[model samples]
Target: MMNALAKQSTVLDLIDEYDRKAAGVEDAIKAYDDACTAIEMAGTIMGTYVNPVLRGKAYVHAREMQKNLLSSGWKAIYSRLNIDMIASARDKKLFERTLADPPPLTFENAKATFGPYLENPRSHILRGLAETFAALDPAYKSHSKVKIGVKGLPKRVILSSFGDYSGTYGRDKLRDIVNALASYRGQPLMEHVEFNAISVAHRRGDDAILDGRVYVAPERYGKADEYQTLDRGLTIRLFGNGNAHVFFAPETLKDINRALAEFYGEVLPDAEEEGAKPRTGTAVSKDLQFYWSPQDVIDRALEFAGIIDLKEWRNNSPEPSRILEPSCGDGRIMDGIRARGHRAFGIEYHAGRAAEARAKGHSVLKANFLDCPAKPEYDLVVMNPPFYGRHYVKHIRHALQFLKPGGTLVSILPATAHYDHGELKGEWRDLPVGSFAEAGTNVPTGLLKIRTPSPSTQRATSW
Candidate 1:
């Protein structure tokens, strides 16, 4: 009986001490609230004063005092609770919910509720505080309004700012959409458009500004696609993060929508009756013979070889040189070469394509490039060979034999070809995804630029 009475007495003493401490905590909280109110009132009065110098000095002093108070108070609270001052988004949300209608303010309850936050606090506490403030204060809640115009975009093209929407189209459909647009616009649209990653910020009064860099192509084509910058006319910006922005002249909006809708299915509400139908083309075959390199891609390959510059080649007088394209189908690469005032020679196995090249005033041999003699005569050899299986490797290796010592060979091959060709030494650049969409293939491709070793360098290595 005596031991039990002693235990009861100890419990009573603890309860008493707890009550007293709780009372002290309440009083301190009230004092802090009063101090904050007093500081705010003083600052407001100082702002109204006519003397700018005195007001400025007072503001500085008050800000410093407030900062010190907040820092000290937060530190004390964190130390007392044995909890971190920071919290992750999930933990912060949990904290907010717990604080909204908290249980009796007890240590056990706090520990139970914020156990996860105490374990890991990855984000700053100020963000949670700002959110809380925004909830309570109208001024804090006020944000700049953002309006994105999407009526000019295709109906199938989804728009998202805060990542709330999943797109309706898959990558293949998206590529087809871009290809359709390119056909309608009668130019390479992939190089001019941006796709599959975007960030938006508020500009002034209902306007949102999007800022992002050009999408560099990946090594192997995945479900994601990338678009480049278009300087003239319409600019379409699409992000992989499900954000999209389309900027165009008011007059061009109709044409732009029509172009996108050609492959995206549904036309805009205000589209004309002569709306575009979905593009139909020959499907990609296993042989990969139908893949025609886009002019932009061909130009990029030539540029990689230093044979021509897309920007200045037309303006500057051409330095006549011999460039070769093996298995050049329809003379697309040859056309790019001749446009730069270089003599373009092609070896084509297809009689029709060879005839077409000849029709374009290009000197093309109507024979198999592999069967042709390997002569170190050309200054540059630029070609897009067959991509089926390991045929590209064979073509690239054979093409090297035609390069003069110190001559560069630029070829477009499968993205994985670089890895496959362990014996060949070259620099590889990934072409953008959907680069060959208009060419009847979506296989990811890359540019390989390799230079034949000069005779002196070869001799030194041989020694």
Candidate 2:
């Protein structure tokens, strides 16, 4: 009887220890919840500041907090917790459905959308900030240091420097980024002030170092670099080492962040979906009407025509040939032909494009080549015709009529045209893929060369 009583007592002691550990775990969880609440409250307060200096300081602090949280492996922890919660739910299917159909504008959704931007240093948002800073500060040169001053803002903020060569940002490359940022204006995004700076750097052994530290004058903040005053009430200054100082109202910062999140998460996806739908009739006609050939493609087509020897054309030895371009939008091919010392003429269907070509000093007629009578007047014919619905076949056949008996015809046609139109005799060379991507199209193209039958061959065939 004593052994049984001792065993019961031992079991009770073990239960008591387990209860104590459970209580400790609950307390830890409560403390964690409290800390998160405090952080959220802090963020809310920081975002409400109106003073530029205070807002800037708050922005810096928030960024530091974000860096710390991300570095502490919170992402992995959150991911694991998310999975465990869904897996352990009373109804797993319902939990998954709820996650999939989250409230569109809720804080949780916004956080999920913008979380990757905060974590990635080279994200589009950060790069946009860098470019805006570079555009505002004229004194900001790549791999240099310069003082930046805001007219209304009094505080001088020093940005952290980058340590390596790969960290540098060039001013020339910021043009496209600046243009993209400008395009965001009036779209629920905040726009603002202008600031400029200039500085030089010297190479020290294998490292590039700024000549002097950035200095802001106490009175009037020094002379302004040639900059137009903007009314947006925000200023950004950049260093060549990719550090940037941004000054704006805290509310504006929130608005910009929210706008960007919406733009990336919703607007862009909708646009892509709209573009994915197949086009019919006029839509297809407008989209496929023109895809200008790149200069390299033009040179290759000229080489295939056997008019001017590409190697000795520059030496003024090879005789220049007369060339005609049909459907020459803006006369780019004509310019190439002229550059190679060839006599070039063009026929354009678009009035505005013909005027543009004429303005460039090229002889272009505002008429369709198909309507014009082919006189077999040209020594060589080079054209990049419309590639829609095998339209290139009609254009190629008509262009051949303009070629002399011994003259060659070179046309930039779709690669599939070579296989589809086996009736047309020619030497087809496939152009590199994505050759027209810079011109806003990705249609695979090939250069087709065909020579007219000379008098001797015609007579022999007639016999």
Q: Residue by residue across 81-153, what tens digits does model 1's lDDT show?
A: 4343344233434644554344543445445655545563321232232232222222221111001234423
Output the worst ten-in-a-row residue range by lDDT, candidate 2.
Answer: 264-273
Best by lDDT: 1
TM-score of 2: 0.39
Residue 46, model 2, lDDT:
52
| Per-model TM-score versus the true fold | 0.40, 0.39
- Model 2, 1-463: lDDT tens digits are 4555544323234334434544465455556666655655565665564433323222223334333333233223334333222121122334345444333232344356434434642233323433343334322211112112112222223344422344334333222223333334432121121112122111111111112223232235566323233333333455566654434444444433433232212101111112334344311223334567788898888778775644454554766777899888898988888776677899998788899999999998888778889889888999988765456777889999998888889988765566444557889887754456456443446789899999899999999
Best by TM-score: 1
Q: How far is candidate 2 from the true structure (C-alpha RMSD, Å)?
A: 26.0
Off by over 4 Å in 1: 1-288, 309-318, 419-423
Clashes of each: 5, 9
Residue pairs that clash (backbone atoms under 3 angstroms), model 2: 136-195, 137-196, 137-197, 138-196, 138-197, 139-197, 139-198, 140-197, 192-232
